[model samples]
Target: MPEDPGLPAGWQADSVDGDAPAEVERLTELLRAHERAARGWASGSEEDVLVEVHGLETRENVVVRDDTGTIRAWGSVHDRAEGRMLYVHIVDRTLADDVATRCSDVLFAWAEAQARQVGAERGLEVQQIDTGAFADDERQHAWLERAGFTCVRTWWQMSRSVEPEEVELVAYPEAWSRDGVEFRLVRREAGGLPDEADLRAVHEVLEGAFTDHFNSAEETFQEFIHRLREDPGHRWDHWWLALVDGEPAGALVGTVSESSQGPDGSYVSYLGVLDTARGRGVAKGLLHTIIADAAARGRDRVGLEVDADSPTGADGLYTAMGWGTKYVTESWHREVPVS
Candidate 1:
């Protein structure tokens, strides 16, 4: 019998454990090459991508190598979405179209199939397959369309360089206090981990705050902490909680990431203030705290991302606070039925 057409020709597929340093380095180089031409990818070192695939658990990380044994692309579905969604990544534009198509199509199809399977396990009502492509990369857009994805939303990738300044420069403490808001880092134990009680408080605040945010979903506490810990720079000290009159009112979670152009600085992975606590400077207070802590640690920048069409006008808040857009990426999603 002839080889299966559903599988790419002259390509061998291997399911990786997603825990190898070699795999991370290979994918990072492949992505960096694509970045040069597309500028659509979020950039970071091998450690960044390494920690990602090797996250809590990945359904699979597929490597596509030509007959010559050259890596043309890398793809993966980090199966952490609790079956509601499958988040995938494929390093496009790094290989010739014929070869890339043969490899990538198979990888993408595998991801979709895996999403359905996982969703079934979780008893989900609908399954979503999520991925991204640069707005300008028609090649990727074309591939996405051919594979059944539709462009839904555009995202702004923004960053800002940080400089040393007095806490007065952030200057929000007094204003926040007047509104009965207080900011403090999550308490740490002698062993250097965040206090369990304080950590749980931060999670509760975020759960309530993003109830109306985009594509919001409930995540188990195990999933939340493990996902963030996968980053190489995650630390207990970087987490903070805001109090309104000594009651937990909000939370901010920041971490450092690898940056090639400058020193690695803090990235706001999550920030939320309860609905009832809005308009009282809790968000501002958290930003000020992050900035002050970054300065204290001698880091050179503080970066964050916001939904461009956010109803809350979050992009405006970040712009006024000194961050600016670096580039853009878009979310392309397609729904699949759980089987």
Candidate 2:
């Protein structure tokens, strides 16, 4: 690798390899520290850190140091789906904004070069930089805008505290019911992995549910499976599937996040009801089941992210169920022609 021309004096960059123990430890520490300062999430231990670093499709960790050899800033870029899209996570600066910006420029330049290299190897035509910024994070929003990105969509981070007080379950209209509709928690047949048939059904339901949504990328069944498997918090038993007359109609996937740094922090990672199943009790049933499970687990709160402008008005459903917006985040995209 050649030296980055954008790097300011005394700052240096290093590439991290998951196979290298020392590199993993250093990057993990940097990420964990950043999490503590930026978000209330707890930092993962070295072992847990390896899970993320090793699972990424393509990864590059850049560390910036000062003249005194003290670490100043760190950033990582990961490639997903054979190099067509890249996700930037855990970018943090130990120094001030001016110094951080210069370091970030160097890091991004390297990322662009790596993207080009990966694209060439995979025969891809375009490279995408994907990231999300919290609505309250003015600094990050400004940085992203200045870097030529635009906010394209908004997500509401919502949470609801589970209290023992009198609570009533929301019911769907009788006319919304589909014949033979049923709901069940994903169970382990023999081993701990999810049932293949059930998993496929869930994926199908999700695809159908979000078809009309903005920027709904079609995901292959294998890709969906791989994604869940990649998450450190993923637990198969936490998943629920709604069926209409014994066929999958919708699904909700839940996970426990120690990252929340709270006594109650379980999250509903994915929730969807197929188009054919919409307006039925499937969505309500799934939410009820998931919330019950979370409460049973002694979780303090349950949370999920929803598109604020969803055509289906999903955010309203969540709010009606007692969820309140904790924060907002925006997704920005710049589509590049595949050709």
Highest TM-score against the true fold, candidate: 1
Q: Write candidate 1's Cα lDDT for 148-185 as tens digits.
A: 88988888877877677734545442223446777777
Best by lDDT: 1
- TM-score versus the correct structure, for each prediction: 0.90, 0.83
Candidate 2, 34-118: lDDT as tens digits: 6555555544667556655666555555666667665555555555555345445455546677877776666556656666766
Runs in model 2 deviating more than 4 A are 1-4, 17-51, 56-60, 67-71, 81-86, 89-92, 117-123, 164-180, 259-264, 336-339
Q: Listing every candidate in turn, what is its Cα RMSD in Å to the true structure after a full C-alpha superposition?
A: 2.9, 4.3
Please give the CA lDDT of all the candidate structures: 0.74, 0.68
Residue 180 displacement (Å), model 2: 4.1
Query: How many clashes in each candidate?
Result: 0, 3
